[model samples]
Target: MKVRATAKRVAFGLCVFCLLVYLVFPFGWALVSSFKTNAELFATPARFWPAHPTLEHYRHVLANDDFLRAALNSVFVACSVTLVSLAIGALSAFALGRYRFRGRSLVLYVVLSMTLFPQIAVLGALFQLVNALGLYNRLPALTLTYLVFTLPFTVWVLTGFLEAVPIEIEEAAIMDGASPLQLFAKIMLPLAAPGMVTTGLLSFIAAWNELLFALSFMQTPDKRTVTYAILSFSATTSSAFEVPWGQMMAASVLVTTPLVVLALIFQRRIIAGLTAGAVKG
Candidate 1:
């Protein structure tokens, strides 16, 4: 029995090691390849390590005006979407979670339905609407489009967290002459902070990494987000289609760094928020 258990433990550890390698290998390769010259990258032996690592790709990416502009565009659009979605979602969540109005469940179902809809399904209609609003090629267009996804998700998650908050606390605040606004701002919002952070982080990440809408709506070069900018490298004048793999990898690392740092910093909050309503006290 002890021999069998030891074998099982060994098998489990091997499985975990394989999973980690599967997940980490691509990013690890990208990190390594980012520093390799084209000649070294295309070498016959397939060098795991560059003969001579270089910082030129990173430097080039950092100095490029378009890359910098695209980074700023991503930041602006993502931040806007997160803030707007959270503000509106919080109110909608409070209403849905707290109130027992007509069609309340229906409303939640509708919101969930919106979230589940494929972006491709709404692409044509959204494009037309953006053009009608004269927001085409604009950063605000991305922000507005992002709301279609982020707001629904935020509302649903926050609603769950809000529902978990003790009703007794709300009643006490109301009895103490707390108006609806005071109750929400002071009591409910504080209690649901973990959920807000988690939802907001998710929303921000989605908006930051969104590619389809960013590609479809935005036409101006400078206004494009980092995701779209990555593809821009594919169309260099050096050749009809010569992708700068090194620079692309370097840019990818830069683009991914912020998200990694964000998750690392708020990982605890994310876990706490996800588990907040799982067990009722």
Candidate 2:
């Protein structure tokens, strides 16, 4: 029996090692490749470590015209979408979690149904709507469009979190002459902080990384987000025949680094928020 258990442990360790390699390898390769020059990158049987490690790619990407603007655009749009989604979602979730209302399940079904709608299917109509609203090719338009994706999930997650908060605590607040607003502000909101953070982070990442809508809605180069900025390297110019892989990868790393840091920082809270209501009634 001991021998069998030891073998099982060995197998589990091997499986975990494989999974970590699978996840880490691509990112490691990207980091390595980002340091390679254009000439070195195409060299046969690419070197794992560049013989002459260079900061050229990072400098070039950062110095590129409109790169900083694009990064700021993405940050602004993402922050806006996350904040708006959290506010609206939290309010709706609180209402649904705390009170019974007519068509409650139906409302949830409708919200979930919106999530099922493919972005591609609505792109044409949404583009027209944005144009009609005179918000075409603007960050606000992208933020609004992102809502179609983030709001549903935020509402769903926050509803679960709010539901998990005990009614007894809320009841006690109510009996202590707490107004509805006071109870929610002083009690429920504090209790739901973890969920809010989790949902907001997810929303921010979604809005930040979204490429398709950013590509479609944004036309001006200076107004483009980081995802759209990648296309700048793909343009066919007299001097360049191929995309700048090193710079593109470097830019991608820059764009994604903050999200990685955020995830590392709050991974535990995110897990707790996701699981908070699962075990509760």
Candidate 3:
């Protein structure tokens, strides 16, 4: 029995090791490929290390005026989406989680159902609406459109978190002369902070990486986001008649670096937040 158990443990370890390799190998390849020169990249069988590592790609990408503008547009859209989604999601979640409203389950089902609809299906209508409002190709329009995908998920997750908070605590706060606003702002908000961070992080990442809407809505080069900028690298041409793989990869690395750092820094809080809602309930 002991030998069997030992074998099982070894098997589990091997599975985990394999999973880690599967996830990390692509990133490792991208990182290495980003440094290789155009000649080195297309060489047969591709060497793991760049024989002549250079920062020319990074320099070229950063030197472009449009890159900075695209990055800024992405940041603005993502930040606005995250803040707005959180505020609206939190309010809706509290009503659903704390109060005994008629047709509450029906309302939640309808909200969740929105997530099932493909973005492409409504793109035409949304584009027309934004254009009618004179917000086409604008950052605010993109931010508002992003909420269509993000808001439902945020509400679902936050509702779970809010429901996990014991009602007795809220009652006690009320007994202590706490107004509804005070109870929510002081007590409930603090307890729900972790969940808020988790949901906001997700919303930010979604908006940051969104490509379809940005591509469809924004017409001008300057109004594009990072994803659009990256696409431009492939779309636009140089006199050389070759794609700049190294520079594209470098741009990708630059764009994703902050997200990687954020994930690493908030790893603990994110995990805690995800589990806290279920654990308390």
The model with the greatest lDDT is 1
> Ten-residue segment with the worst summed lDDT in candidate 1?
234-243
Could you tell me the lDDT of residue 156 within candidate 1? 91
lDDT string for model 2 (1-281, tens) is 99999999999999999999999888788888899888889999879988888989999888887889999999999999999998899889988888888999888888878889888999999999889999988889999999999999999888889988888998899999999889878998899999998999999999999999998989889789988888677772235777788888898888878999999999998998899899976
Which residue runs does candidate 2 get wrong by more than 4 Å? 236-238
Q: How should the candidates be ordered by lDDT, best one leading? A: 1, 2, 3
Report, for every candidate in turn, its global Cα lDDT versus the true structure. Answer: 0.92, 0.89, 0.89
Clashes of 1: 0
Model 3 alpha-carbon drift over 4 Å, by segment: none
Select the stronger candidate by lDDT from 1 and 2.
1
**In terms of TM-score, how similar is model 3 to the real structure?**
0.95
RMSD of each: 1.4, 1.5, 1.5
Report model 2's TM-score to 2 decimal places: 0.95
Give lDDT for model 1: 0.92
lDDT of 3 by residue, 1-281 (tens): 99999999999999999999998887778788888888999998879999999888888889988888999999999999999999999889888888888999999999899899999998998999889999988888999899999999889888888889988999999999998778878987888898889989989999999999999999899899999999888667564577878878888888988988888888887887777666653
Which ten-residue region of model 2 has the weakest summed lDDT?
Answer: 231-240
- Tens-digit per-residue lDDT, 1-281, candidate 1: 99999999999999999999998888889899999998887789899999999998898889888889999999999999999999999999998988889999999999999988899999999999999999999999999999999999999999989999888999999999999999999999999999999999999999999999999998788899999988887775378766789999999988887988999999999998888788888
Clashes of 3: 0
